[model samples]
Target: MRTHKYRTTDVAVDGGTLHAGVWEPVETIEGAEVPTALLIHGITASHLAWPFVVAQLPDHRVIAPDLRGRGGSHAVAGRSSMRAHAADMQALLDACGAESAAVVGHSMGAFVAVVLADTAPDRVTRLVLVDGGLPFDVPAMPDLEPEEVVNAILGPTAERLSKRFADVEEYLAFWRAHPAFQESWSREVEQYFAYDLVPVGSSLRPATSLETTIEDMLDLNTGSTLTDALARVAGPHAVRDAGQPSVLFYTVPRGLQNEVPGLYPPGYVEGLLAQHPVLEHHRFEELNHYSVVMTERGAAVLGGPLREAITERPAAVG
Candidate 1:
């Protein structure tokens, strides 16, 4: 087994102080001068979600922060949203002394990367989004009440607020059996769930709340959040113009749990991808949403296409 060493730090950002995990490359690859990258986890996840990727990018310094209300840093002063999360990332980057670094985000973290690139373009040299880019295409989730949304965020493994499991083995078993994780099982997959919770009383609970999840889902300008951000990445655009420059989008052929089985329509991602002229889309034949981020193979499949895109960053344009 490969042991990964990381440091934990807390820093104040837009709304509150956040917990972050930092890992320096154990080995260096020739010609890869860049020493840093930020790993942003998806909704209901924390810094632990990026271990496989962090291990792969041994040449780059990696910083993984548990967004404001998830993972090790669950407490926050106020509600959480994409904008707030983006600002938190900026604070993390600044604290790490990273002037410019490549950023990789999965799921909701992918959306946060878009907002970060849009709001603080100078901080990011390149951006890689895994299974996230466009806004929620399922329309307002009126039928899904606030409590229902919260339940999903906690999952079945969570025990209470701000605390998770200390027993890594037990937690791993719970995660392996989860319907969302059924398709993804690997060492990285086990680690992904192991890091998401902190022990509380006799059980474990997620660091983030359903309220936080609901706020992000409803308040994050779902309509134009991604469309606008992608356009900025592509370059200058008129107020009325839509679409981004040099953006690469990757999607799984089958939607994740809520997206297709529980939430979005099958045609939603296809329709969204069509709007962006510069996006490079790759389709995975069998993987679902969670598996794409939870397993090593999932990350490899994503990293291959994304690496190609970064190497071919769009030419400088007026």
Candidate 2:
């Protein structure tokens, strides 16, 4: 049985309108301000990817938006950069009347979360980075071409943007065969895939724009804003109030596929954790890149740590 409810709202951003999916609890506290959490989806995803996580957070209001070029916000014009995404987030928060929020981002959304915190630290109170936030060790691969890097990193996800399906069911068939879903399929996955389809001519295509996908992917690897944010979040600088803000990162052992390793390169995350005391990491051996947050079990497991972060204050970093 469905127990949660979500609302769709639009806000005027710098370039165009931004569409958001906001989930509210079944019951509310009397007169008290509801704490909001900004849930950011991956590059090729929308707010629908978070139904399971939203289900887990009954007390806190979850505000999720289609970041510029996907879902209901796919038509939003202008540039789609991390900084632009961050500014849109600020506008969404303002529209929601939330002065601050616990920022939760998945995949590329995690990248935007870090940028949001770095660009506007005051707006963010705590962070939960699910399989993203830090740079993905692109520096280590000096020999690979830029396109090769994106292809290597994104793989089938990037390829699916151009493919057309006869119907949403056809799209579901494609995903059912995917290794990630073969073992752990659910209604949440179906809803997420159905929302991914947008009508194009007589057929249906993914709501995500191919140009937006490649542009964002390239920027994530080369963008100065992301690395700058990471440096601020990681390094002790004059910019921040305390040291690093409390961070809890959940990652998977395998990549989107069987042979590929998870997004973060080998030994990369450990080095980053070593430098930043406030950044705590958890590695899920049984889950893959997609299953880490997509599956129900993943969300239930992720929820325990996530709930603690929501209520618990950041331990002071020395």
Candidate 3:
């Protein structure tokens, strides 16, 4: 069973139509304004990635949109920079009449959320960054190429997409075989897969264009304007991560596990928390990157620590 019902549509933003999905509260509490939440997914993922979180955020209207070129908003094209994605988020908020809302983001979406908060602090009432933000504190090796960082790990899956499969089932067979899906996938994740692909010329291709993927990698690493954007935010904030199945950086296969004692690096969220004294950090010791946002544990991660972080803010001075 789902936590809340959702609506889907095309929203005009930044000169093009972007696909957006929204889930709102079925019931409102007394004297509460019915908060709104804007969820931004990571690279290559769409609004579908948020079902688990949306279920728990039932009291607040939850909104998740395919940032520019992913999912149902495939026809749109852009440079795939985080700034552009942030701008699209702003427009989405405007269209929904949410002058300000709680912003929740995962992976690359976290990068955008930081940028949005930085760029338009007035427009964001609160922020929750999941498994991202605060750069990985690792040294760059001389031999490492940029592609090694972006495509190498998922290279097999990307290449296999070109092959013709009998149907979605066959494709899913190949997809499930990938190491990324080894642990387990839920029904929502399966539905996410269904919505992520579109049939083109008898072959099912992921809705995101290759250009969008490539350009995002380019923008995030070298031209990433987010670090500066995150610096400007001074408001209610929270950062959370699953402590197990570590997410990190290194040169070897399964390097994340071998790299360090922590999932990220020392001071990973420390710097941001230091800057914003109000920022709260919650680390779930048993979950991993994906499950941190997809499972029941994820709901608790948001509801217990994160929800308190946002709602417990001190009253503003007159």
Question: Best TM-score goes to which candidate?
Answer: 2
Clashing pairs in 3: none
Stretches of model 1 off by over 4 angstroms after superposition: 1-5, 29-32, 139-145, 148-173, 199-203, 221-245, 258-267, 311-318
Candidates in order: C-alpha RMSD to true structure: 4.6, 2.8, 6.2
User: What are the TM-scores, per candidate, against the unseen true structure?
Assistant: 0.78, 0.91, 0.80
State how far residue 268 of model 2 sits from its true place (Å). 2.7
Candidate 3 displacement at residue 70 in angstroms: 0.4
When summed lDDT is taken over every stretch of 10 residues in candidate 2, the lowest stretch is: 236-245
- Candidate 1, residues 1-318, lDDT tens digits: the string is 343458888998766688999987655657766556788888788887777666566556789999987876777668787778888888888898887667777778888988888888777766776777565544445567665544443344233333455577766776666676776677666666666666568876665766677687654444576566667664335122232235556667445442343222347655655655455556665666666656677667666665555444433211
Q: Which one wins by lDDT: 2 or 3?
A: 2
Q: Which rank order by TM-score, best down to worst?
A: 2, 3, 1
lDDT of each: 0.67, 0.81, 0.65
**Where does model 3 exceed 4 Å of error?**
137-146, 152-166, 234-279, 314-318
Instruction: Indicate which candidate wins on lDDT.
Output: 2
Instruction: Report the C-alpha lDDT of model 2 over 191-308, residue by residue, as the tens digit.
Output: 9899888999999989987788767877887648887787776554423355444677878777777445677655888887776655778877677777777888888888888887
